[model samples]
Target: MLWRSPRREDAYEIHELVRQCPPLDLNSVYNYLLLGEHFSDSCLVAERAGSIEGYVSAYIPPLTPEVLFIWQVAVRESARGAGLGGRLLQRLLARPAMGRIRYVETTVGPDNAPSRAMFLRLAGHLGAPVHESLLFDRSLFGPDAHDDERLMRLGPF
Candidate 1:
């Protein structure tokens, strides 16, 4: 498999692959594509035999100059375990535009071991710090309702 930057032409295949992943809101794919274009970030695709098998999107915000946020990464079920995800990450990290980046960050659900493991391994390889914390959202009921709104915060890188 080969990883390359995504073209506008690859939107359909990227959307289809993202749709197959659970916990993803398929309705927002169009907006996601727009975000990538607007930010000049990398939206990369992994292709095999002329078909897109996976993709990863990453952005380095000007406000947070030294940090790269890996927004999303997904691989087709048939393409899993092929190291496509790692390759896509490596390509994103190697981008000239990101040369000044000192940290890479991402958030994963606490129970999502595979996603967490992926980020951990990447963090280790890059020798960056990974801080895991409980992410809480405001709730209608009260502050004690934090349990229902908790997620994980795995960075500032």
Candidate 2:
């Protein structure tokens, strides 16, 4: 797979990828367009044979440049397993723009074992410890049924 920064034209496809990857909240294509156009430095996409296989949406918070808050990770079913998720993350951190990033933060639902495991493996590979806390309670989603989102912080590496 060719890992590279996302392009604005990839927004619709990325949105569709997220939509197919269930359990992951799908955001508006406009949101992805903004990330691609403005935060491309912090976002990444993997393509093979001219097909988008995976994508990771992340950004360095304005007040905390050292922290990379990953918004979403989506890998097509055909590309599942084989460590594509972890590789995507490693590739993201390896970018020159992410040189100062010391902490990686993401939210995972309690029952999302695949996501939780992928993040834990990333922390291990970074030689960092994992710290987790409740970031968003299910109740905060109001009437929309949603799982409680817990923050996962892997850091200072």
Candidate 3:
């Protein structure tokens, strides 16, 4: 797979990819376009044969430039397994603009084993410690029936 920063033109494909990857909250295509145009340094896309295979949306928080806040990770159904998700994250952190990033943070639903595992593997590779804490309560999602999202942080890498 060819990994690179996303372009505004890739938003629709990225949206479709996120839609296909369930348990992942799909944001509006316009939001995705903004991620490409404004946060291209932290977001990434994996394409092969002109088709989007994976994507990761992340940004360095303004108040915490050392932290890379990952918003979403999506891999096409056919691309599941073989560590594509983790690879996407690794490539994202390897970007020159991310050189100062010393921590990675993301919220994951309680039962999302795949996402949890991916982060754990990343922490292991980085030789960092993983810390979990309550970030968002289920009720905070209003009437959407969303699960509680807890913060998972890997730091000082």
Candidate 4:
């Protein structure tokens, strides 16, 4: 696998990869390209045999000057478990533009064990802490809010 910056042309393939995952959303791809323009060299692509296999879009928001937020990360189902996600993340972390970023953060939805595990492994490698939180929501037919739901935040990457 090879890690490189994403090009406008890779949008479709990236879109498919994200679509195949749970909680699918494609609108983010367009936003990613728009944001990519501002952080030109930060968006990345992972390819194998000349085909796009995965992608990650990370940025250091001005409001959070010292933190690098990993806005999105997705690997083609066929490419999962091959370390492409980790490779993309490692490349992002090494960029000189990210030097001032002391922490890298991402949110994994409750019940997403694969993602949670990946974040835990990455946090271990980076010596960062994994913070957990509960996400509550109200039902359309109910008065009481939903109970605890796990969301993980692994960072300081």
Candidate 5:
């Protein structure tokens, strides 16, 4: 698989990848287009034979320039279990523009064990400190509620 930054043409493909990863909030394709075009420097996409197979959308938050907030990571079902998601993240953080970033931040549902484990493994591989704290409560989403999202940070890398 090829790991590289995303492109506008990959937006629709990325959106479909996200949809196949059940339970992930499917953002608008236009939003994905902007992400691919505007934040390509920080995001990553995995492809094989010209077809998109995985994506990880992230950006360095303005308020905390040292932190790269990973907004979303989706891997094609057929590509799962070979660590594609983690590879996507590792490559994204390896981008030259992200060299100054000292930390990674993302929120995950407490029950999402796969994601939770992935970050833990990343922290171990990066040899960074990993900390967790409450990020959002159910009330924050009003009625169409989801579980609390806990903030996970791995950093000073």
Candidate 6:
């Protein structure tokens, strides 16, 4: 798979990929377009034979330039277990725009073992420390609609 920064044209396809991964906070295509266009430097997309197979949407919060807050990661079922997620992440952080990044933050659902494992592997690869904490409670989803999201921090890189 070709791992590269996401393009505006990839917005819809990336949105589809996110929807396929149930329980992921599905967002509107417009929001995805914004991410692709405005945060392309921090976002990544994997293409296989010209089709989007995986995507990682992330951005550096304005006041927190040292932190790269990963918004979402979605790999098509056909591309799972191949470590595309890690590759996409590494590439995104290695980009020139992330040269000053010192921390990586992401929220993972308690049941999402794959995502947790991927982030752990990333932390190891970067030789950074990892910390976990409750970041988003079920109440944020209104009426216990979804599981709480735990924060995963890998840093000082």
Winner of 1 and 6 under lDDT = 6
**Selected candidate, larger lDDT, 4 vs 5:** 5
List the candidates ranked by lDDT, beginning with the highest.
Answer: 3, 2, 6, 5, 4, 1
Candidate 1 ranges with C-alpha deviation above 4 Å = 27-29, 135-157
- Candidate 2's C-alpha runs over 4 A off are none
Question: What would the per-residue lDDT of candidate 3 be over residues 19-92, giving only the tens digit for each residue?
Answer: 99989998999999999999999999999999999999999999999999999999898888889999999999
lDDT of 6 by residue, 11-129 (tens): 88888889998768799999999987888788888898999988888999999999999999898887889898899899889898999999999999888889989999999999999
Q: For model 1, what is the C-alpha lDDT against the true structure?
A: 0.69
Q: Pull out the clashing pairs in model 2.
A: none
Candidate 4 lDDT (Cα, 0 to 1): 0.72
- Give the C-alpha lDDT of model 6: 0.89
The C-alpha lDDT values of all candidates are 0.69, 0.93, 0.94, 0.72, 0.87, 0.89
* Candidate 4 TM-score versus the reference: 0.81
* lDDT string, candidate 4, 1-157, tens digits: 6777877777767777777865534556677567556665668888889888888877777798888777678888887887778878878888888777777677665667677777777888889887777543325326654333344566665
Our model 3 lands, by Cα RMSD against the true structure, at 0.7
Which lDDT tens digits does candidate 5 get at residues 13-126? 888889899668899999999998888898888889998888899988889989999999888888888888898888888778987889999998878888888888899989
Which residue runs of candidate 3 sit more than 4 Å off their true CA positions?
A: none
Counting clashing residue pairs in each candidate, in order, gives: 0, 0, 0, 0, 0, 0
List the candidates' TM-scores in order: 0.80, 0.98, 0.98, 0.81, 0.96, 0.95
- Give stretches of model 6 more than 4 Å off: none
